[model samples]
Target: MSSDDDPPESDPSPHVTAVVLAAGRGERLRSELPKPLYSVCGRAMASYVLHALANAGVSRAVVVVPPDGRGRLIEQRLREDAPDLNLCFAVQQEPRGTADAVLAAKGQVHTTQVLVVNGDLPLLSAEQIRPVLCHDHNDAVIATAQVDDPAEMGRIVRDSQGRLVATVEYRDADPAERAIREVNLGLYVFRSDFLWNALEQIVAQTRTGEAYATDAIPCAVRNQSAIAVEVELPDGRLNVETPADAANAEAVIRHRIIDRLLDSGAHIRDRNAVWIDAQASVDEGAVIEPGSHIRGNATIAQGSSIGPNAIIEASTVGRNCNLESCTVRGSVLHDNVEVGPYSTIRPGCTIDSHAHIGTHAELKEAHIGEHVQIGHFSYIGDAEIGARTNIGAGAITCNFDGQSKQRTIIGEDAFIGSDTMLIAPVRIGNRARTGAGAVVNKNVPDGGNAVGHPARLTPSRRAHSTTGDEL
Candidate 1:
């Protein structure tokens, strides 16, 4: 990533196009949703693969999908999530093997080098891809991983002269072949010309009756044109096929997200308990406590401390803010704001700097100015309050009238006594005061005082309008 003043690299991106294989129907997972659309941690499974390609500097991609209604739904979501990437869709007309799936993307292939990736690998990273694409002279680059038990994988084959040869799947291999620890992860980078030529010569196996993409290795090797480069990834592939696999992949992604935050100097109290979504951002010096769920474009700025237990969704918290035991959604809290112990701030709310919302308070569609203090056990909805206003405990803004909602305006330096209820379409002027347990239904002019139920004007030092005139 370039700094603010750094000069941009002329072509920092690699000159390779990517084709993501996503036509697989994962019956093992036993879910109605498509495999590519399955939720992995906080995002769809295929989105991680697309992000890896983008981070690896692959500018354009073609995602292969089935020609079904589900594919259209997936396409809509992909466009919404990744609008910057130049995405094109290719329909795999039927259920086929890897080689046949690659052929579906024939029309979209334009670059000299092509990266073929499995869409199920949600844990794929750009660092794991660079080793394969970095080899300029290699005809093909295969990514392999080492596992303790190499079951249900293709073992890498070598010749007598210790040269790279082919990959033999465990189902078709003999005893010795299945023992090899290094297995193919079904990810490859290939030269465009060799990819097209080698895939055409593949013969379908009798067991599956499908043309395997692995057959390309032996074809290239037999021609004495195979230059295979292998990369052994440390994290391995997080491909999901079953329910258990989905849980494991979700755990891995959760760790990865938290680890990235820790590495960037964010303080998290308990690493295992917090759930930070894929797109959430926490600045340096921010603190995230245990049992917090941060999701959907949530950003915690520097010097902010959030939750021992809280949920923040699609909200922004400014610097030096503090929140605890609260849920905030689609709202903005400015600098030095203090919310919660137990509060719910809903959408379309703006809390200005130095405002304090005490415990058990809720605000929806409200604009609160600076230094305003709303005590505990209150509900303020569809209201606008000026700066330096002190709202008493158990206050309620009755802004809803069963048919339509209305707004209330409270001016600066106004003092409301405890348990006061301000009715809809009401205005309290600057320096106005309300008595305890007052049910206010009319506007009070500047320096006016209201008292009792269906409140009447109280005696004041300066004369003021008690005629409920709205400014």
Candidate 2:
């Protein structure tokens, strides 16, 4: 079931291939993580660029990764994140420049054209790139953007006719060349045949003697085959090279998501403080309070109110539900469910409609039926509670007895009194009742009443107060 909330991985066309350069190890980010692995708005950096490639009708995507564990990690993530994009991982044997990375994907570059993109541009979107990919006049179209600081980025050089003449690399550019505001953003659409022919001509290396992709553009312009188009991206097409760059990129993405959510009818008390992952869904009329962190594939349906400091990851929240400061991970809550000002619902738990989980209650691998009420300070794990069951405050389902977990089953209309402990592998039948502070270890038959530690079951709904007999 694919929804708009999932990662934007569209089906690619069969005309052109995208060569994504992702082999760099981000030393500036100060983590052992490969640059492409850096997360922005809860998604890897490269996934956004690849999504743009797919959305722009690229035939396939060839991700260039380093040759090691980092490469495998990237490959695995790409496989999961953008499975719809016909993908191939090509290993760049060494940390190299943009030209070398493109060359590495030679095996998959069988199309008439190739779109070269930097993997770190987390703000890249398909709408910002449609024109460049659709340009068919020149042998290649260079993507240029105006930046406040052109530090270390290639400057787009244009001829008198306003056509692209060359891309002057920062390391080799003189004072006049360095003053250009329109700089190459490292995104290009090239004729595949021309690119192959030009790549072989790029023997000139940079100061560190690495093959330079920028150097190829000047020779290409001399052949009158290159044209540069300046496009203004809303987020300025940030190239995330350092930790600060990563932060800026995330800020831009956060604003984008928040604004889109607000426009889509999701209300947030404080948009700046909330962090909703790109893949998470907040339907129309959903109210998200400040300090809410919704991540992964979590979905909050219409009219639902979540958080003041809640964490929901990979969970489904049905319509009109109200959730306070709770942590729900990999759980499902049906319509009208009320969960906590402080509750934890762990993986594999499913609560049916109108179920109420009180403050500080926790549930794990529990199946709760409609109209069920779990009181405060209760722990229901590896359990199944039927419809209309009322679990009193401080109740505990002792599902794990030091060795392994066991099941506790409570039937329909059952009333579990306060502070009761239902031991492992136990069953309380329909309309059953448990006295306060009772510890029931054995099965209580239908309509039975349980009282005292190692509770003894009686025929009546409760024990006789004075006689204390099992009437």
The candidate 2 region of ten consecutive residues with least summed lDDT is 462-471
Clashing pairs in 2: none
Over the stretch 1-471, how does candidate 1's per-residue lDDT look in tens digits? Answer: 100011222334456888898888889889998888887766788887887777766788899888889778778767766624579889888776878888789788988888888888887777666667776456677777777767677788778875777788888888888888777876788788888877766634335657766677776677765544555555544567789888888888888788888878899999998988787888989999998988866899999999989898889899999999899999999999999788999998999999999999999999999999999998999999999899999989999999999999999989888899999889988888888888889887877788889776776622677452531
How many steric overlaps are in each model, in order? 0, 0
TM-score result, candidate 1: 0.84
Per-model TM-score versus the true fold: 0.84, 0.90
Off by over 4 Å in 1: 1-13, 31-33, 67-69, 83-85, 135-139, 161-165, 168-177, 197-218, 224-228, 441-448, 451-471
Highest TM-score, which number? 2
TM-score of 2: 0.90
